[model samples]
Target chain A: MINQIRADMYRLTHSWGFYITLGLVVAYSFLITKSKSVGGIMVNGNQDALTRLSRENWTALDGIRGTTMSSSVLMYVLIGLFVIIIGYEFSQQTYKNTLISGISRFQFITAKYVMLLISILITIAAYFATVIAVSLILGRHVGTSWAHLMSTTGITTIAVAFFISIVFSIAILTLIVTNSVVISSILIVIFPLAVATIHIFADWNWLKYIDFFGVSNDVSLGKLTISQFGPYLLTCAIILVVCIGVSLLTIREKEL
Target chain B: MTETILDFNNVSKKFGRFQALDSVSFEIKRGDVYGLIGENGAGKTTIMKLITKLSPLRHGSISLFGETTGHYQQALKRTGAMIESPAAFGNLTVDQNLKVIAKQNGIQSKNAIDDAISFVGLEKKRKTKAKHLSLGQRQRLGLAFAILPHPDFLILDEPINGLDPSGIIEIRKLLYKLNHERQTTILISSHILSELYQVSTKFGFIHHGKFIKQLTKAELDKEKQSGIRLEVNDVAKAAEVLDNAKIKPFSVSNNHSIFVQTNQLDTGKLSQLLIMNGVELNGMTKQEGSLEQYYTTLLKQTDEGEK
Candidate 1:
C-alpha cells in the first residue's frame, strides 16, 4: 500500500494537470483575496476618492471570510483533481499496468484515496496561506493581537476541510461507479446545486445535511450549535462511509 | 518433468449474455514459449486476462507457481503481462512512464530501467512522450515494460501486431534471448502463425472458448502431413494433368504451384508425368505443411465434429 502511494505521488506530481490545477488555485486565491479586501474600491471620477480607497484598512475577519468563501468555490474547482487522479487511469486504461503487477484492488483504491486527501489538503493550505498573506499586506489594522485571527481562521478552515472532504469522497465514488469522466463531472456539478435548490422549496431539516453549499454557509459563519452540528456531521459521516463502501464493491469484481 | 509455471483448470468467464471462456484449461511450463493460437474472440485474450486477473476468475481455478489461494498476488508478483494493447500514460515521457512501473514493482535499481530501455531499442526516445511514438515504438515500449521486472513468467498478447518485418525478427530474437539466457517462461498469442511457429516450443489451439488441442512444436511437425510440391509454368494445366492421372488429393495452392499429399509420392515420376503431359513442370521438391494449413485443417475438423 505504501509503495502504491509512493508511485501515485510521483505520477501526480509529474502530471501536467496537477500543475495547471495548482496554478488555477493560486490565481483564484488572489482574486478572492483582492475582492474581499477591496470591495467597491473601483476607481471613481474623483482622484481624492481613489486615493482614500487605497488607504482603507482590511481586518482579520476579511481574511477569514475570503478564505472560507474560496473554500466553497474551491470544492467545485477541485473536481478536476479527482478526474485526473482516478478517472484518467480508467479512461487511459493505465490502471491495468499497476493492478497486473500483483497489487490488490483494495490497496490500489485505498492508495488513491490517500493521495486524493493529501492533494486536497495541499491545495487548501495553499489557498489559506495566499489569502492570509494578501490580506496582511492590504490591512492597516489587523487586530490588537493575532491570536483571535489565527484561532478563528484555524477552526473555520478545519470545518471547511471536513465539509469539502466529504464532498470529494462522493465525487470519487461517482467517478469509480461511472468510470466516465464526463458523467462524473456533470453529476458532481449538478448534485450540490440540485440538493440546495430542493432544500429551499422542501424546507426539511434532513434535506439541509446533503445540501453541500448550504452546509458550507452555516459552517463558514460558525452558526452550528452543538445540537445542530452533531447530527449534521453524523449524517455526512454516514454518507462518506457509504460512498467508500460502494466504491470498493463496485470495482471489486469489475472486468477491467 | 519440468516445473509448471502456470496452470488453468476449468476456467470460465461470461460477459452478460455472452460466454467468453468456457472451462478452458491449459498449462505453460518453465522455459517454454507457449504460443496461444485462435481466431478472433476465441478466448485467447480472455485467458490472458484471467491469468493476470484483469478479469475476475469466478468459475474455475488458476494457479501460479503452485499457489491457488486468494488471487495469488504473491505468485503473480513473479509474472509480467502486456494484454490487448499497451496501456500507457500518453502525456508521460518514456522514462517517466517506466519509472511509474518500476516504482510500483519496488524496483529500486536505476540500471534495470536503463537496461530495459536499451533492450527494446527505445533509448533514443526515452525522453519522448508516449503519444509521440509510432505504433511500433509503442509496442516495443510495452515489451520493455513487461520485461523490466525480469519476471519468472511473461504473458504477451499479440506482441508483434504493430511491428515491421524487421521489427518482428528483432522481437523474435529477443524472445529467444529471454527464454535461452534468462529461462523466462512465456505465454504469447499472435495472429501471425508463422512468427509464432518460429518461437514457440509448445502450442495450444483454442476455438469458441475451448481448448481444441495442445502439443509441442515437434508434435505439430509430426502431425502435419508431408507431400510433393511442384512449381509449374501453368498451375491449371499441371492440376488438370494430375487429375486426369487420378493423382490422389492434390491441391493447386497458388498461381504457379500445386501440392500433392500422397504417401507414395514419387517426385521423379510426378515431374516427368507433368512435363510429358505438356504442363511444363519447372521445379519439384518435397514440402512439409505450414502453420496456416495446420490451423485451417484443425478448425475444419473441429467445426465438422461440432455439427
Candidate 2:
C-alpha cells in the first residue's frame, strides 16, 4: 500500500504538465493580487475600479470571487487540468501494467486520489503564497494580516477549491470508465456547462444548488447554515458516491 | 510434494451474453515456467486477471502460492505481473516510475530503487521521462517494476508483444534467468508460440475462454512423437474418419495435413488403415509436431467453436 502510494506520486510528480499547472496557478494568483496594486503603472483598463474593488491584495480566501470572468475561467482550467491528469494515465496504457503488480484496485484508486489531493493542495498553497509575497514586495499589503493565513475562515475558504478536487476525482472515475481522455474531457465540460446553464433559467432557487459550483459557494461563504448549502452539498455527495461506485465497477469489469 | 504456486479451479467469467472465461482450471508448480498461449481474444488475459484477483471469479476459486483469494496478499506479496501493456505514469521519469512501484511495494530504501533500475538496465536512462523511452524500454521498465518485490510467481501476458527481435531474445533470456536462478514460477502468454516455446516448461492452450489442454514440455514432446502427416480429398470427412478410427495425433496441419510422431504408429499399417477406412491417403509422411502446429490446431478448434 505504501509502495503503491509512492509509485502513484512518482507517476505524477515529474511531468512538465505538473510543473506547468503549479507554475500557472502561482503566476495567476500573483497576477490577481498584482492587479490590485494602486502605485507604479497599471496595465488593464479597469485598474481604478479594481483597486476600489478590494483593499486586501491577497489572502487565502480572496480568490473566491476572483475577477468574475476568472471564476468561470479558473473552473474551466481546473476541469481541463483534472481530466488530462487522470486521462493521460489510461491513454498511455500504463494502468495495464500497474494493476498486475498485485496492487489492488482499491489501492490504485486511493493512491491516485491521495496524489491528486496533494498536488492540488500544493499548487493552491503556492498560488496563495505568491499572492501574499507579491503583495508585501509591492507595499500593497493594505488590509491584509498574517492572521488571514491561520484563520478558520481562511481554512474553510479552501472548501471552495474542494470542487476542483471533486472534479479531479470524477476525472479519475472517467478515466476508469471511458478509459479515453477526449471523451472524458468532453463529458466533463459538457455536463458542467450544460447543467450550470440550465440552472440559470430555472424558476426555483433551490434548483440552483445542484452542481459542484453551488457546493463551492457554500464553502466560500463559510456557512453551512446558508440557505443554498444543504442541497448543494447533497448534490456533490450524490455525484461523488455515484462516480466512485461506477469507477470501481468499471475497473473490476475491464480486462487489464 | 512439488509445491503448487497458482491454482485456478473452475473459474468462469461472463460479460452479459458472452462468456470470456468458462470453467477454466489449471495449476502451476513452483519453479515452473508455464506458458499460456492462445490467439487474439482468447482467455489468457482473463486467466491472468483472475489470478491477480483483479477480476472476481464468477463461479470458481483461485489460489496463489498456497493462499486462496482472501489470503492472496501473501501470494501476491512476492509476485509480479504484467497482464497487458505496461501501466505507467507517462510524465514521470523511468526511474521515478520504478521508484513509485518500489515504494508501493514498501521498498523505500533508495538503494532498492537504484538496484531495480539497474536490474531493468535503465540506469543510464534513469532520469529520462517515461514518455521519451522507446517501446522496448518501457516494457523493460515494466518488467523491472513487476519483479521489484522478488515475487515467487510471475504472470506476464505479451511481455514481448511489440519488441524487436533483439528485445524478444533479451526478454526470453531474462525470463530463463528468473525462472532458473530465482526459482520463480512464471505463467506467460504470447501470440507467438515460438517465442515462448524456448523458455516454457509447461504449455496451456486456451480457446474461446477454455483451457482445453495443459502439458509439460516432456508431455508435449511425447505427444508430438511418432506424428504423421496426411493430405487427401474430402479433408473434413477424412479427418473425421481418422478421428473415429482412434488415430490420435499431436497436431493437424492446414489443408488436411496431420502430424503424428515417428513411433506412435506403424506407417505401413497407418496408411493402409486410413485407406481401408475410405479416407483417401493422397500424401502421407511421417512427421513431428511443432509448437506452431499445436497453436494452429487449437486456434482452428476455437474458430470452429465460434462458428
Candidate 3:
C-alpha cells in the first residue's frame, strides 16, 4: 500500500500540470493577501477599503478565511489536477497495467486517496506559509491569545479539511463514473452549480440542509455554530464514504 | 506432469447483451507459448482481461499459478500481461514508466528495470516519453513492463499489432529468449498467424466467443505439412495406380483427385507411372497448409456450423 502511494506520488509530482496548479494557487493567494479581496470580488471599488482590509490585525483565523476564500475560485485547478492524475489512468488504460502488476483494486483506490491527502496537506501548508509571510511583511502582529488562537485555528482546520474531503470525494466519484477527464471536469463544475441553484431556488426548506456549497460557505467563514459544525462534518463524512463505496463497487465490476 | 500456469474453466462474459466470451476454457502449462488466435471481437482480449482480473469472471473461474482468480492479487503477483495496446503514461519517460511498475511490484533493485529495457533494445530511447515513441517502440516498452518483474507467466494481447518486419522479428526473438531462459509461460494472442506460428508451442483458435480448437505445435505442423495433389480422369484407377506404386495416397476425392501427404515423393515417377497406366493426369500441384489457411478454414467451418 505504501509502495502504491509512493508510485502515485511519483507520477503526480512529475506532472507539469501539478506544478502549474500549485503555482496558480500560490500566486492567486499572494494576490488576494495583497489586495484583500473576499471571494475574489473586490469590495466597494475603493482603494482605501483595500488598504484598511490588508492592514487589519492578521489573526490565524483571519488568515484561514482569507486563504480559503481566495483559493475557492481556484478549486477548479485542483479538480483539473486530479482529472489529469486519476482520469489519465483510465484514458490511457494504465489502470490495467497496475492491476496486472498485482495491485488490488482496493489498494488502487486507497493509494489515490492517500495521494489526495498528501496533496491537500501540502496545499494547506503552503497556504499558511504565504499567510504568515504576508502578515509579517505587512507588520501585523498576532493579537489573539493562545487559547483563542488554538480554538480558531483548530476549527478552521477541521472545516477546511472537511471541505477538501468533500471536494476530493466528488472529484474521485466523477472520475470513476465518467473515466474521462473532460466529462468528469464538466460534471464537477456542473454538479456544484446545480446543487447550489436547487438549494437557493427550491421552496423546500430541507434543500438548505443538503446544500454542499452552503455548508462549505458557513464552515469557511467560521460562521457555523458547534451544533451546525457537527452535522456539516457528518454530512461530509457520509458523502465521502458513499463516494468511495460506489467507486470501489463500480471499479470492482467494471470491465477494463 | 507439467504445472499449469493458467486455467480457465467455463468462463463466460457479456457486454450489454452481446456475448464477448461464451463458456471459454483452456489451460496454459509451464514453458508453453500459448497462442490465442482470433479475429477482432473474438474474446481474445476478454480472456486476457479475465486472467489479469481486469474484467470480472462472471460465469466461471480462472486460476493463475494454481490459485483461483478470486485471490487475484496473489494469483497475479507472479504474472505479467500487456493487454490490447501498450498502456503507459504518455508524459513519463520510458525509464520512468518501467521504474514506476517496478516500484509498484515492490522491486528494490534498479537493475531489474535496466535489464528489461536493455532486453527490449530500448536502452537508447529509455529517456524518451511514451508519447514520443513510435508504435513499435511503445510495444517494446509494454513488453519490457511485462517481463521486468520476471513473472512466471505472461499474457500478451496483440503484442505485434503495429510493427515493421524487423520489429516483429525483434519482439519474437525477445519473447522466445524469455521463454527459453526463464521458462516463462506465455499466453499471447495475435491476428498474424504466421508470426504466432513462429513462437507459439500451443495454439487456441477462438471464433464468435468460443474456443474452436486447441492444438500443440506438432499437431499444427502435421496439419500444415505439404501434400501431393493429383487430378486424374479416373478416381478408382488413380488410387489403384498410386497404390500399386506403394504411394498409398493420404486421401482420394470424388473428383478423381488424390492427396499424397508427402513432400519426399518422386512426383516425376508418379506422373510417368500414371501415364503408363493410361491414367489421364489433367493437373497436379503441391499444396502446403499454412497457419493462415488453417485459421480461415476453422472460422469458415464454425460459420457454416452456425448457419
* Strongest candidate by lDDT: 1
lDDT (10s digit) by residue, model 3, range B130-185: 99999999999999999989999988989998889998999999899999999898
lDDT of 1 by residue, A1-256 (tens): 7877878888889988888878887778777667652331111112342243345444555555545644555766777787777878888898888888889888887787777888877777677677777777776356436776666666666666666667777777887787787877776676656665666677666676665544544554556566877777888889878988888888777778
Clashes of each: 0, 19, 0
- Candidate 3, clashing residue pairs? none
TM-score of each: 0.88, 0.78, 0.89
* Fnat, one value per model: 0.85, 0.64, 0.85
Model 1 TM-score, all chains together: 0.88
The best candidate by TM-score is 3
DockQ values per model:
0.71, 0.42, 0.75
- Cα lDDT of model 1 by residue, B6-106, tens digit: 88999888888788888888888999999999999999999998888888778999989999846589888899899989988898999999998999899
Clashes of 3: 0
Please list the residue runs of candidate 1 whose C-alpha ends up more than 4 Å from where it truly belongs after superposition.
A37-57, A144-148, A213-220, A225-228, B229-259, B262-266, B273-286
Candidate 1: which pairs clash? none
